[model samples]
Each structure stands twice: as C-alpha cells, then as structure tokens.
Target: MTFPLIKHVRAFVVRGGGADYHDQGSGHWIDDHIATPMSRYPEYRQSRQSFGINVLGTLVVEIEAADGTVGFAVTTGGEPAAYIVEKHLARFLEGASVTDYEKIWDQMYFSTQFYGRKGLVVNALSGVDLALWDLLGKLRKEPVYQLLGGKVREELQFYATSSRPDLSKKLGFIGGKMPLHHGPAEGEEGLKKNIAELAEMRERVGDDFWLMLDCWMSLDLNYATRLAHEAHKHGLKWIEEALSPDDYWGYRDLKKNAPKGMLVTTGEHEATRWGFRMLLEMDCCDIIQPDVGWCGGITELIKISALADARGVMVIPHGSSVYSYHFVITRHNSPFAEFLMMAPDADKVVPMFNPLLLDEPVPVNGRLKLDDKPGFGVQLNPACKLHRPYTH
Candidate 1:
C-alpha cells in the first residue's frame, strides 16, 4: 500500500459560479430576494449580491502526487483563500504522503488556529483537505465513496432547494425546500405572505410531498417560533437555519417551541466538529446540515457526521454536488442528499456546480446512481478560466 509523496500544491481562483455557487449572474433564483441577515436593509433586500454573498468567488486547490496524478477540489474562498492555501497551507502537503491526510489536516488546522478556527481559513483548509482525499482516491484507483467504506444504499435520493418547490415536485424529488423571501424586518404583512406562499405550494404539491422553508439565518427567535407554528399549519416538514449559527440557545428554544410535528434544522454556515458539538450537545436542531466544502471538508465532516450518528441525528449535507454525493452514499445516517436547483427559474435540472466541474452528476427523477470513477468522479471544467492568484 505504498503511496507517492505529494509533489506540488497549487491554488487558483475563478469567478462566476463554480464552487462559489452564490456568485451567479442576474435573474438567478438563488440571488433573487433570498432572506438573509442583511435583509433588514431596504436596498440590499432585493438581491443577495448586493450584500456581497458572492464576493469570495471560488478557491480551487490541486495536490499533485510525485506520480504525476493531480487531485483537486473547489470551495468558496476566492483570492483570500487562495493566499491561505499557497502561502500557508501548502507547506503541510508539498512533500507529505498523499495518504497522510489526517496529519496534513491536523497541521493545517492548528497552524492557522490563531487566525482561523472556522469561516474563510477553514474553507481554505477544507479545500486542501478535500484535494488530499481526491489524491488518495486517485492513487488508489477507487471512487471516493468506496474509499469511505462503500455505499449503504443502492442510490441517493434528494430533495430540491429553490424558489419553486412545485416545479421540483414535477421533476420527481421527494421534497422541495424554498427560500423564505421575507424576514421579520418585513413585518406582519411579510409574515402572512411567507405563510401564504407555503400554503399555496402545499396546495400545488398536495399534502404528501415534503415541503420545507430555508430561512437563511434571517429570523429572530420570536419570529422563527411564530413562522414555525404558522408553517406547521401548511405541513412544513422543517424550518432551516432560522436563526444565526452562533445562537445555540436560540436554536434550542426554537427547536423546543416549534410545532410538535415540525422539525428545526440548521448548520449550513457552521464549521468543524467543535462548532457542531455545540449544536448537538445543546439540543439545537433535529438535523445538522454541514456543507462538505465549508464545514471542514471530508476529514472534519467524518468527525461531525460521527458525532451526529452517535446521537441518532441525521447528517444531510448542504448542496455540495459530488463532494457530498461521495460521502453521503457511504454513511447510513445520511439517508438522502440535497440537489440544489441551479436552473435560473427552477424549471429544470442542471449540474449543481455548472461550468466549474466536468462530469458532475445530477439526479434523474430525484435519485442519483454514483459511478466508480476515481476521486470524486469529476474534474475541474477545462473550459472554465482558473486564475492562479498565488503560488507556493
């Protein structure tokens, strides 16, 4: 089981939607009036880009083995992350074994802890960690899923996240999660509108299909509680990321106060196992959604998922396309996956990270059958321009 030493590490930044899926152009459903912490401001409320959600662009990390095999990963961090990867993180992997991901990850995290326990620094570290795993898979000539212990199920089932769940239902997803367009700042009328939208969609999709709301950390405790109760009337399966990720106490209260049948979910913005320990140990939410690209890559996610699995909690990763697909298929706790509707109007299915990844998989009729391709079964899109902002 000899593995080649890592030879070169490179970091690149690319703009306009890849790993930075939020950097979409005008008229994309993702950028259209999605509720957020910045929604209180009248001007920025209309579009997320106005609040700089997509400002980071994308960070791509490539780890090349001495054998000339290159494994790469993409995450949202842009030039800042690229700088971290090239100037800081690359030292851990340049001459390390491709199989020493654990040691490399430990060094990368501890060396940067003075500045980054989470967020941008963790994102850069995560990109490198994922690239290491990709390199390991390539070196072993196995798909990442098999490297993770093989699939527990025959295929992956998914729910759609978009502005229109009705269209997703027609597309055959098991559930549809719509963005909550108006937050507490929008007031009572906005509250009514939010429930009305849910009710309307519930009617269109019938009572059986699972419908949920993604608040995107825009609601207060009182507002989230109220929304939960009202949305429960419409058979809302869950209310997601209703409060700020730091509000563990608030999440605990919201989880308790939410309607008996409705579930409280959060953690898309959370990072690392320690952060998730606060969520789980505090009884914060029913399900913890960690984005593979953001929540410390596969290495940290393995720890995070194990924590959740031990407590009988489900770990449904956020919309991370193949990075999530490879991990999700191997875990029993992750029964299904999330397919973010990348289509501008949510009218059709498209690759989640379009134009950034080649051979990226998408669900057909709400299900995905993963192939045995090495690494994550995809490659950086050759046509997409990658900017090498920094070099180690």
Candidate 2:
C-alpha cells in the first residue's frame, strides 16, 4: 500500500441564487452608510444598491491524487481565484506528494508574492491549502481534526449570526449575533438606534442568552467603544470586526476603551501569520476570527492559532462552514463555533454554503457531531454547476 501522489489541481467559479441558486446571498459587507476611504460621496448613500458588487460568488478548488482520490473545498474567490489555481498554482502542486503540504503551501505563498499575499490571492491559496488538507486526510484515512492532533472537545456549540435573534433563540442556539446595519456615517442617532436595537433584542432574548453585534468592519474606534460600553449594560458578549482589519490602532483603542468583561474580535479578513502577529502583539482583540478559506487555510490557521494560544487569545475562524468546523474541533482555544444562518429566512439551520457542498454537517441544536469520516467530512455537490470563467 503506497501513499498517493498529488497529480491534478482544478478550480471553478460556481454561483447560486438566480437560476441554479448558488452564490445568491446578500449582506451589509459594503454599505453606503459607511464612508470608506474608497467611496465617501455623501450622495452614494442615496442609492442603497450602489456597492452590492462586494458580494462575490464562490470559488471551488479540487486536488486529485494519482490513485484517483479527490479532495475539494470552497470559498468566496470567484473567477479571479479560479484563474490563479488553474494557471499558476497547479504547476507547483501537480507532482507533490500528499504529505508535502507545508512546503507546497510555502511555494504557493512565495511564488505568488508579487501579486499575492493578501485578498483574493491568499483566498485562492487558502482554497488550495484546504483541498490539500482534505487530500492528506483522505490519504491517511482520518478526519482532518484527527490529523490536526485529534479533537480537543467532543462536540461544538454554535452561535447563530443572523438578523433574527428571537428566532435563533427558538432554534436552541447558544447565542445570536446580529449584523449592524448602521455605521459612523449614520451619526450619533444611528449609534443610539443601534444600541436601542440591541436593547430590544436583549429584552426579547432576556438576560441569560448571548447577544452580540457583528459590525462588519464599519464602525470607528469611538463608535465601537461607545457601542461596547452601552451594549454591555444589556450583556452584549462581544463586538466583532467593529473596525477595518487593517486598523490595528483602532482595534487597540477600541479594546482599551471597551467596557470591562466585554470581548473584542476581528480578523475575518486578516490573512497569514504575519498579519495576525500585528493583531496579537498589539493586543488588539480578545478573539481572532480567521476564515479557514481565506486565512491561509488549515495549514496557516494552525500557525495563527498557535500564536493566539501563546498570547492567551481565542482563535475563532470565521464562518467557513466545514473548513473552519474541522479545525475548530481540534483546538482548545476555539471554544465555540459561529454558524452563519444561511437559511433564506434566517430561522432554520441549513448547511452554511448550502447547495455548494454535499455532506456538510450543520449544527444540530447548536452542536455539530463529527463522525470518523475521512477528510473534512464533506464532498462537493456534483449538482453544482461549475464554470471555468478563465482559461489557464
């Protein structure tokens, strides 16, 4: 019995929502109410759908072993990521062994140094890295968590990130993270409205249940500090991504000024260990949320989590579905999971990237049960309409 060699790499841009119903989702990732440096026109806020292009579709990556074993993962890289994988990255990985993940990851990271390092390049690299982990796990006949040093806990509790916290409470989730619709541009009145909304939710879910705000990198240092301070009275567990990931100073200020017992979390958009070093070293946030599909995959997350562990900070990978779920189960630092309420109504618990992944286990009563399935315990949906948006 010989180990299989990595013989093939493939990437695809697949979407949902319109017809085949894949990449079709919406959020406040880029709101006109938020005056980012890129777009500050006061009139831009007049048209609500102006910056909706921020929501790119999904990019799927696959690595096939010489023995015909196939491992795959998905992320939000779209066609640009597909181009990188099929054109540049495949050449470096085609002849490597399944166990050559670290070296291969380095080659991918350094080879794309000119145009890569952050944003979609790291995202593509993350997809490839994740596929490699799944490949290695399949080769070893073990779950990814087992390969990552076995499970630290038997099951994972989940907090729902959705607009309807009241419905989430009914679903038996531990907590509900509401997305903040207003930003600093909305003015002090917006701040009061945001806090009032939290107060409303607090009144609804009562004192025991956890209620947090996912500001989605829109609030400023003062606004975030104030939100945390005011919302703390209502028992807001944490304030997440209140400012941009690059705003280390803002994070520092927010953390310093936050109410005692309140937690600050960021890093959903931060990449690699070096980027995370700034976050940990600055003592920016209490929890670091690295998306496994974007933060250098499981390969880099292990390193990032190690950094967080040493600094006594929790590493909660963003809602990357099974990609994060597998890694979360392996570490003690990642005490709980964040489940993005992907159901159209945000009431039911469906697979995070519904229709894109087969066998992706969503949480059952806010807890996910992992069997001894090989790899990340997920398979790509054959029904998914994959499009190669570029030739490489």
Candidate 3:
C-alpha cells in the first residue's frame, strides 16, 4: 500500500495528566517519605515532601499524513519536548513519506548530535518517531506491533511496581516490585530496615510470588550489593536501577556479584542505541529496561532491543502504557511487562495515562492483550485541555 506523505508535525503541553504511581499521599511507608531523590541523603532526610509538579503535566505529539491520518503519543517531557518538536524536529518529518521514518530518525539523531544526543531532545525525537509508526500502522490498518513484525506471545504477563503486593496478587498480577526507601547514606541500620520491610512483604505474599526492589538510582555499589545479599533470603527476583545510571562499572559489579539468580535491570533513564551500547558492551545488567517515550521513542527502542536480543538480554520497556504495550507484545525476549499501578491508594487499578489518552487498555488477570485496532488503538482525550507552550 502506498501511504500518503507526512504533512505535518505538532505537539502540545497538557496539565493535570499523570499518575502518582508512588502513591505519595497514601501515608504508606515509602509513599509518605522522601519527596525528592535528594531526600535519601542524611542531611535532607528530614526535609522530605509528599509531591512535586510533574504529576499534572505531559507533552503529547501528533503526526498527520496528507490524507489526514493522525497518530499521537503522550510523554513526560511535554513542554521542553514541544520546543524540540516544533523549532527543529518537525523539519525532518513534514513533507517526508510516512514510510521514511527510519531515515528520518537517523537524520534527526545525527543532525541533533551537537545538542540532542540524549535526554529531552531524544525524548522529543521518540515522540515524533512513535507518531510516524502510528501513522504507518493506521495507513496499513494494523496496530504498531503488527507493523513491527507480529505478536511473539499470546498475552503479556505483568508484574506490579507498587507498595501493595498483596493487593496486586489479589488482582492476579504475576509479581510485585516495591520502591526501596533507604540507601547507603542511611547506614547499616537503614539496610536492615529495608530488608525487614521486604521480608514482611514476602511473607504477606507467600513463597511463590515474585518480589523485586526498585532502588530508583539511589545507592552505591556496596549498598546495592549488601541490600541484594540480604534481599536474597526474601526471594527477591531482581534489583532495579539500584545505582546511578552513569555508573556502568557499578552496574557491572552489582550484576556480577548479585545474589545467585537475582537479576539486575537498569536503563529506564538511558536513551538511544549508543547509550544502551555502553550497558550491553560492558555487561552492565541482566535486563535492559527502556521507556520508549524517553529512550528515543519506538525507533531507538527497536534498535536497542535488537542489540539486546542478539546478546540474550531482556528488553522490557518500562511501564509506559500504550507506548510500551505495542513493542512488548511483539518481542520474544521481553517476557513480562512492568505495570505501574496508578491507583492512588494502591487499592485499585486504573489506566496509567488517564485524562490524556482515550481508549487506553489495562491488563486483565496479570496479562495484557492488545485489541485489533489500527495504529495504537488509543486517541487523545477530547476532554484533555491541550495548550501549545511554544510557537513554531
């Protein structure tokens, strides 16, 4: 099928559009503690807060073809990303053929190397690339996964990343991962407390359920190793982003020395294939977790996953709602997905990107199955007030 030309690229910033997966106001242990990453430090521990601003903001992108077919995606870097999308990135996609996304992605990546190798620029690039894929899928009357290849699994099993593992188990999720509250700065006493909570949760969930820790880039190699050593007896499945993302050497050490059978996963903050190559080549971690919205969108993720697939490493894109669902369903190595339980109290499950994207799918029985809809099977919520933060 000959698809129409890519006619326009546009982006908007919407406020009040995110989920508090951390359950900040729930008064739960970690939820009630640590407002910012800095709070983990001993000096700032007492100054912790309950919430921050981004919970209500996002950037949404849309790519329109000549025939008026539109594909869109929503991401966290909405305001800043809009600047990249309009001031620069739009030039590469507008007037290009819809099928020329790979070429467009390469051009966008290389052309912006001076100022956009990673971070917000790549995030903007990712939104645009995803919109292009959505456009191509719409033109072919197929979902993005079908366009990628085809489904590699019958259904996507999910593990919950929330405070309430018991609730997650009751909801039929395969496993539950909790955010670690303390780090090395808290000393040995803090490490003991971390283990104590994990042990309590393990007992609550029983022996068969999988338990994991999301350290959230808040530990040193020694702290992560010690935490892993203690968490091992609690049946921890893996430890995620325990150290700073730049610590490739630390990651290599943690993975090499982690408790036997414990998996190490990072890259939720890492972007692009080149960035991922650092992790893969150095043998940094056991699994690679890329958020397609941040890791150069769907385009860079495919390349990252291809590299990981070749190396026998897993490529589970972080819990990014529809953006990730399309990719995970098609890859063989991404056996399970991370579902961010957005329920404020961690008492109920809801759509991850509510008030921004319509027709968003939620998992059933710890498994997610995509519907047979064209493009991503989702649309911008008409009720979502979109404001263009920049003029192009």
List per-prediction Cα lDDT, in the order shown: 0.93, 0.83, 0.83
Q: Which one is best on lDDT?
A: 1
Which number leads on TM-score? 1
Could you tell me which residue pairs clash in candidate 1? none
RMSD of each: 0.7, 2.8, 2.3
Clashing pairs in 2: 15-23, 16-21, 16-22, 16-23, 16-24, 17-21, 17-22
Sum up the clashes in candidate 3: 2
lDDT tens digits, residues 277-319, model 1?
Answer: 9999999999999999999999999999999999999999999
Tens digits of per-residue lDDT for model 3 on 200-279?
99989999999989987878888889889989998999999988888999999999999889999999989989889999
Candidate 3: segments with Cα more than 4 A from true spot: 19-31, 34-37, 40-56
Q: Kindly report which residue stretches of model 2 are placed more than 4 angstroms away from their true locations once superposed.
A: 17-22, 25-49, 53-55
In angstroms, give how far residue 383 of model 3 lies from its true place: 0.9
Give the least accurate 10-residue stretch of model 1, judged by summed lDDT. Answer: 94-103
lDDT per residue for candidate 2 within 155-187, as digits (tens), equals: 989989887888898998999998776677778
